[model samples]
Target: MGATPEEGAAESAAALDEVAESLVSLWSLAHNAPDVPVPATQLRVLFILEHGPVNVSNLAAEMGALVSSASRLCDRLEAAGLLLRDHGRDRREVTVRLSTDGQALLDRLKVRRRDDLARVLDTMSSPARAALIWGLAQFRDAAKADKGPGSAGESFSLPA
Candidate 1:
């Protein structure tokens, strides 16, 4: 008999996790070959900032961290010229944005990572590469449709 739908999903999710780990390892190797300017935690902050400017509390919530810790991270990134902090629409609030240099850094890293991934993909059979692309497109569409725990409104908490 064929696997149940839930079993197939679990197997696919597990495989995707391994793929994600490999990709992360590849990115880390490529990112650090030239010495990354920011710590991993701060890099994550920059990634979140890439979406848009956010205040400390929201950023902290997204990172599952305390506001004080997030502020300290921003302080470090700001000191390194990778982040900017400005007054928010509310007089008492401060918002953080990635600086131009930070964006450039991200852009360069993306190029390098893509080049590396492309090299790996080049070694694969044509059919395998085509399958990978098709699978990834379908997975992306599924992810966009889910809007579950990872959605912005949940902010780290899963639905009951």
Candidate 2:
């Protein structure tokens, strides 16, 4: 008899875990190249800012880190001219945004990442690539759906 759907899903979950680990290794390799050698934590901060400006408190919450830690990271980025901080609606609220240099850096990093991924995908069968695209979209939707009130994503935090 064929395996039940639930059993198949469990197997897929296990496979996804391995895939996630491989992706992290690939990301580290692609991200830590000669020109784009930002540390992963700081890279995460930049990635967050790429989405839009965020205040220190909100950034800390997103990273599941302390405000002081996030602020320190911001300080470094500011010193490096990688980010800009401006007053928010009130003087007390400091909003952080990626500077032009930061955006350029991220653009370079993303291009490298895409090139690396393309090399690998180039070797995969077309059908397999299609399946991966479809499956990843489903996974993304499910992950998003699972992101509230102590769901599995609650444990998802940036590597310290």
Candidate 3:
């Protein structure tokens, strides 16, 4: 007899909490390193937009934020020239995209983040780096399972 299902779930949850904390800490550190003029929330919005233009409601859902709060964040980002709101073909729907300045800022940030990560990875052994990648992939796959069907992992063929 092995551990009960409840015990397994508890262990999984604990692991997830650790991973989440680590992600948040790393993201906070990297995001704040440049001291960009935009607020963190606005930068988050821009990050989402980099994937593609999206409606306010959908973006809010993805960000796990209230629609109103997302709207306010969008307003601030737009005012800061980081985002642009365009009328959809339906006219009733509005789509948000990163503006030219926003793209430029994102590009700069991406380069800086890549440089930082490269520096860190350089200090890690190849096996250690591989293990870290594998662990993160597993974590991402487990998170997608919790999100139900058709999440990001479903689109790719993962090793068994």
Candidate 4:
């Protein structure tokens, strides 16, 4: 008999945690690769805006932050010319949009990060690369299936 399922889950969770940390490091490196480095939090706001324009209140809800804090974040990004802030139909409503510069920054980071990851993958054996791809697909599926807490109906797909 080998380790129990609970033990196996524990081991897997620990490994996943380590991988998450490494990914976060890579993410930070990518964020800083640009000439104008955007703080992680501000980069996050840009990512959120990428989906579409969002009002401050809704953005605050999504960020799990106070509306004032979210507004302040928007102010910094706007000042950096990474995003645009405009009022909704009602003067009381404020909407945020990612500017061309912000989108370009995101595009550059995506290329850099993918290139860095590809370099690492090239160092790995072919079998390992295949395994990593398959494992990531499974992880995406699992995340989609998990409807527990923090589930926001978001789904992700791996590039072909």
Best by lDDT: 2
Sorted by TM-score (best first), the order is 2, 4, 1, 3
Please, what are the lDDT tens digits per residue for candidate 2 over residues 1-160? 9989999999988999999898777756767887764688998899889989999999999888999999999999999889999997768889999999999988888777778778888999999999988987777667656877777555443322
**Which ranking of candidates, highest lDDT first?**
2, 4, 1, 3
Show the lowest summed lDDT stretch of 10 residues, model 1: 151-160
User: lDDT scores for all predictions?
Assistant: 0.82, 0.84, 0.79, 0.82
Please write out the lDDT profile of model 4 over residues 5-75, one tens digit for every residue: 99998999899999989866765677776475678788888888888999999999878899999999999
For model 3, how does the per-residue alpha-carbon lDDT over 34-109 read when each residue is reduced to its tens digit? 4687868888789889878999998898777999999899899899888999988888888899999999888887
In model 1, what lDDT does residue 48 have? 85
Worst 10 residues of 4 by lDDT: 151-160
Stretches > 4 Å off in candidate 4 = 149-160
* Model 1 misplaced stretches (Cα beyond 4 Å): 147-160
| Model 4 lDDT, full chain set | 0.82
Off by over 4 Å in 2: 147-160
By TM-score, the better pick of 2 and 3 is 2
* Count of residue pairs whose backbone atoms collide, per candidate: 0, 0, 0, 0
Q: Of the candidates numbered 1 and 3, which has the greater lDDT value?
A: 1
Which residue pairs in candidate 2 collide? none
